[model samples]
Target: DETALGTLHSNRSAAYFAIADYANAIQDADECIRLRPKWAKGYFRKAAALVQQQRLKEGVTAYERGLVFEPTNAAMKAARDDTILLQKVKYVPYPTSVMAPAKE
Candidate 1:
């Protein structure tokens, strides 16, 4: 099934993460990690997928693992903090009209 896996697959997984398909993205990230365990981005991507899935606890754990290898990654730290805060706040979606988009 190696051929079933490709950069396109990884890219699609990232796209899924962008669109909030967390579970499916995690599946792709799973294969990516299996194929490239030493690759830091793979774990980082998985952490993002986990966060999107609302697996915040495990996502923070994953972020910690990634930090062990990518200590200088600022984005990772910000995301980790964001994940942790999700547990602290009880957010309710507000109406878009209340906060309109910024002017271009």
Candidate 2:
């Protein structure tokens, strides 16, 4: 039951992240992690939110923490590596929205 709830929250966090709502994503992800501390997806969601918020250092920390819980997780490892590379390269994150002229 807890796992299912955690997964549901994780999914919601991902949706929030997709919509560029990093704050809410982080909040939902935190609740997900609290619901199921051992579930790696929560940490991944949290890390993704932090990264999207431009909190690169914090994101890397969260990702690494998730790796400790799931050393064999390829997705987590890949995301961590990508985040690290982006940090190293000083990657400029793109704006979450694109604006166009309003139609009359």
Candidate 3:
């Protein structure tokens, strides 16, 4: 039951991340991790949210922590590697918020 709830939260976090709503994505991913610490997916979601929010080091740490719990999770391992590779490249984050015209 707890895992199921955590999965729901993780799924919602992914959706929020897809929309560039990194703040809410982090919140939902945090809850998922709290609900299911043993689930690799929860950690993956949290790490993804953290990376999107420009906290790359923290996100990689989260991935490492998750890997400790599931050493053989291929998807998680791939995600971790991808995150590292992305960090190595010069990343220019896209603006997620619209800007208003400057006041005269």
Q: Please state every model's RMSD to the true fold in angstroms.
A: 8.2, 8.5, 8.3
* Model 3 steric clash pairs: none
Kindly provide the TM-score of model 1 when superposed on the true structure, using C-alpha atoms: 0.70
Q: List the residue pairs that clash in candidate 1.
A: none
Q: What is the full ranking by TM-score, best candidate first?
A: 2, 3, 1
- Best prediction by TM-score: 2
Looking at candidate 1, what is the lDDT of residue 98? 73
Q: Which digits, one per residue and each the tens of the lDDT, describe model 3 over residues 31-74?
A: 99899988777788889888887788888988998999999988
Q: Which ten residues in a row have the lowest lDDT in candidate 2?
A: 93-102
Off by over 4 Å in 2: 91-104
Q: Which candidate is the best by lDDT?
A: 2
lDDT tens readout by residue for model 2, 1-104: 99899999999999999999999999999999999998888999999999988899999999998888899999999999999998978876555554555569
In candidate 2, which residue pairs get closer than 3 Å at backbone N, Cα or C atoms, i.e. clash? none
Local lDDT at 6 for model 3: 91
lDDT of 1 by residue, 1-104 (tens): 65346455667779888888888888887777677665556678888999877788888888888788788889989999998899667465777987898789
Residue 85, candidate 3: Cα error in Å is 3.3
